[model samples]
Target: MRGDVMGCSSQSTITNFSPQIAEAYAILRGIRFAMDAGLLPAEVEPDAKTIVYLIIADAPPLAEVGIVISDIIHICKHYNIWVLFTPRCANMVAHNLAKVMPAEDLFYLEEYPPYVESFVLDDKAM
Candidate 1:
């Protein structure tokens, strides 16, 4: 995306939210946002390998977060989306955003949050 963030969202979840569910939700949100913005033929790079495998295989949701994965699959039916799994170390932006954003509110922005600037810079240099 030319070093320009299309949009970033910090989706805070319940105290008991499963990590898998949270990851799936994040991917789901990203897809929906891109679709709404008319950004088709997207490629998603998620750090969760399980979710990526499930989505790619279009597998039935057997896990607790299957519902979210199902939704992601449904949405992909309307457009071309390639889901790839990235190692956490290479996904610094998402990793830092999860650590820094307040759990009480959802954050959406076109620019990297101040807290995430350092990581973004590091990523760009990679």
Candidate 2:
């Protein structure tokens, strides 16, 4: 979530990687986007627990994916950023957005999409 706001969402396509690697790549991309948008003190919630732990530990894993994780850690050092892990159920709005958005199409919205409004409200209430 971006501060106390919960409706914002962004998605991008990653090529030539496993699902786990792609997830890491997406988180990296999201962090970069937030930095570019001047969203300082950013808070990131990735559904992938392993990747979150890897980033938080600042310990690069073996292989090419470690390079991406290392870059994420490097960029995060410049800003006040916290990477946390949230269960998929708690990230339904984003899950839904990813499903509906076409592959290779990067979708971003400041407010919750109409289709996911209920989920957003439900999350807020909880």
Top lDDT model: 1
Candidate 2 weakest lDDT stretch, 10 residues: 1-10
Candidate 1 segments whose C-alpha is farther than 4 A from its true place:
1-3, 103-109
User: lDDT for every model?
Assistant: 0.77, 0.74
User: All candidates' TM-scores?
Assistant: 0.82, 0.82
**Model 1 alpha-carbon miss at residue 119, Å:** 1.0
Clash number for candidate 2: 0
Candidate 1 lDDT tens digits, 1-126? 544566676666555668888788889888887776666787778888988999999984877798998889888877897778988888788787767546565545567678778878788777
lDDT of 1 at 86: 81
Candidate 2 TM-score over all chains jointly: 0.82
Model 2 alpha-carbon drift over 4 Å, by segment: 1-9, 12-14, 103-109
* C-alpha RMSD for every candidate: 2.2, 2.6
